[model samples]
Target: MNRHVTTGFLPGSALAGADLALPGVVPLERRRLQCYLALLFSDMAALFSGFAAAGWLYLGPDGLAQGSHLAQLLLPIFLTVALYNGTYSLHSLEHALSGAIRAQIALGLAASAVLFIAFYTKSSASFSRVLFSGGIILSSLMLAILRAQMRSFVRWRCGGRIIHEIVICDGGVPIVLPGARVIDAAAHAITPALDDPVSLHRIGVLLRGVDRVTISCHPSRQRAWATILKGANIDGEVVDDAVARLGAQGARIVSGHGLLRVSVGPLGLRARALKRAFDLIFASCALIALAPLLLAVALAIRIEDRGPVLFVQRRVGRGNRFFDMIKFRSMTQSLSDPHGHRSTLQGDPRVTRVGNWIRRTSIDELPQLVNVLKGEMSIVGPRPHALGSQAGNKLFWEVDERYLIRHALKPGLTGLAQVRGLRGTTLHEDDLVQRLGADLEYLDGWSIWRDLAIIAATARVLVHPRAY
Candidate 1:
């Protein structure tokens, strides 16, 4: 059965007749729901398997005692998967499968280590080490295989078999079908390049002709295509090969990487409001919970340098408002370069010893909790841009006007951009553009659960620094 599911990412109006749409082109609503459900189910199954395996291994007659350290360790490992599994969905299954498997293995090893420590400390009775190790190996393999299988199933079920009728507006460039069919095609007076100004007038005409539209172009042309399509009334889909646009929505089979840029517009007002309420409540609680840690970090910073404990700098907030964002001082006070620096170059000398550690560990950002409590920021959203950062100029000014829509919500402590390693500074104009695109994406798809997931993932990354 074709099920119509709504998501925080797509408007309900976009869902009309979406099931009949073509491959590489479904209403954003359906895609978001499908992706979220797939991730949710996979995580549920993995958690269940982990717990089941642990119980069978440690609680059975031939197993280790339930009260043993092995059992305690295994329980936490299982809990870890249950708590953190949602973060894995941030990446496409193909790219993250190996890493997910490795993480499962690491969880097993951590559990084993905890058990060993317990034994060494005489906190538990002796257990069959061989059996325990065997259990770990068996459970790890089983979870990995199950996760892989789940990913495969999701891919198969969501693959394109459905076809959508799309109106194509080609301004005279030889339109290549690449095998896909266009229900109706037209040539406009102005042939708009992907990077060129989108012909909203042309798009409105096309939307009236078909339920959806697909714009195919070279990779370099993608940004422009996206910009133009964003203004169109109809939902837009992208295809690596222009021909694939003719296939059924949710049925076209393509590599995951090709689907990365596919996105829809903002969620409904209700979802946005719900997300804001959630951010306020959660950010408040987080600030309260982390208050002690913040105090300790403040003391450390003060002792390390005779500078301000809290660094307040002008940052672009929601709706292009300028706010003095608060953070633990992680750099020695220095004036910005006269050239109007846009990004922090690698190994910036402005970083002090304590600053380096704090930045790496993300402890320097603890003071942002005050910002959160003050309702100037969120626990999760797009990270606020520095006052003169390239992203502010390129995205807020040069890109599509819709890009500024992201500022409608409060700035976030961590966001989809940061988790995707779009943090730090944009070295290139393209990078800033892409970062803003992601920010706009997050704003369009804001949700309570999504925010929670981002925050959790941020915690994980903070524990293991990669970008810094």
Candidate 2:
């Protein structure tokens, strides 16, 4: 039986030659950004409310005039110092709760110190150091407490909400769905053949198959279930009811069904055009500026081994078209045991010393700049997979048809997947799954800023050890 899973929002139309049902996971960075924004808005509101209350209570009487003047003078400066000291920009604030608190404290101390220095320098006669000190302490405490409380509240509220739609295939156990009643005996049934499509479909037809199921387990499991549902072309909501019901007890089941009605459509041409323009402009400038280094790398490759410096391999590109991808060769000439066609694994004997260096630093990818110039690729999009890579096969056959959405845009020289440690050899199914998920995510959330960020991250990772 063919079974697939998916989570979160489904696309409007399926891409040709791609799986229409494989579940794709949302990237951590995107999720963190959303959570951070929610926290920020809530915290800002809380801060203003606290300030209003404090003003009404402490400054409404004798302190009103002096306090107003002091606040006007100090607030901006304090905020600036706090931001600097805290490293409290929108970027850094995406970390976990404890990290945020530690940052806030550091910011608070620096802000307070800056205010103290400023007041001393000005020799402000009307300013009371005690009042200023008290305000800083109180403000810091309020901000920290409010942020923490809001974070907890948001998590709790979301815990009960359906954040994703998951479909279960390969009947392992009955999935429980939030707000769903499982009165039928089928709710508790487990089919060993749930992974198989024919058997699962038979079960679905027999039970007039359920529309939604819930499983109380780890968040990772929810993600897995969503993937399975997506692959099966069945869409249903994933709720936290299982978690709520299980709550440190035995495992709990929610509800899920075979009925999934969701649209998977291609991105509009306008977005496609915008991304293309961005790619041409940036790729052109980068290639021109790095010409000297690229030449040197080519020369090194040739000198080390008397083989083609540039390697051209067939890769699946936009619209499932075959394209010869260009890259610096990092492998020695070799014969395949089974066949000549195979992926290079880590520590492969075919890798030369220079090849290893180029691969690790991603210098081998430099020639793809020419591909970008020719309009075969973008500066940031999904990295094109080799035609025969295991990752490509799984994505094509096992995932949803919309999984090809990543190919809607031109293949990129550097992509969200590569920058997030999804590059290199795929020795595990999870690796390919993760890389494809990042690729789809890039397509869904494509933007100029995001492309730039990926490029920056790619540069950073190239210098790091794990990139190899």
| lDDT values, one for every candidate | 0.54, 0.53
List, residue by residue over 95-175, the lDDT tens digit for candidate 1.
546545555755655666667786789964555555565556655666677666666555565444222345343432223
Give the RMSD in angstroms, all C-alphas superposed, for model 2: 14.1
lDDT of candidate 2 over 62-125, digit per residue (tens): 6545545555555555445544554334334434465356546654665566567777898655
TM-score of each: 0.42, 0.43
- Model 2 spans with C-alpha error above 4 angstroms: 1-266, 335-341, 391-396, 399-402, 464-468
Clashes of each: 18, 64
Best by lDDT: 1
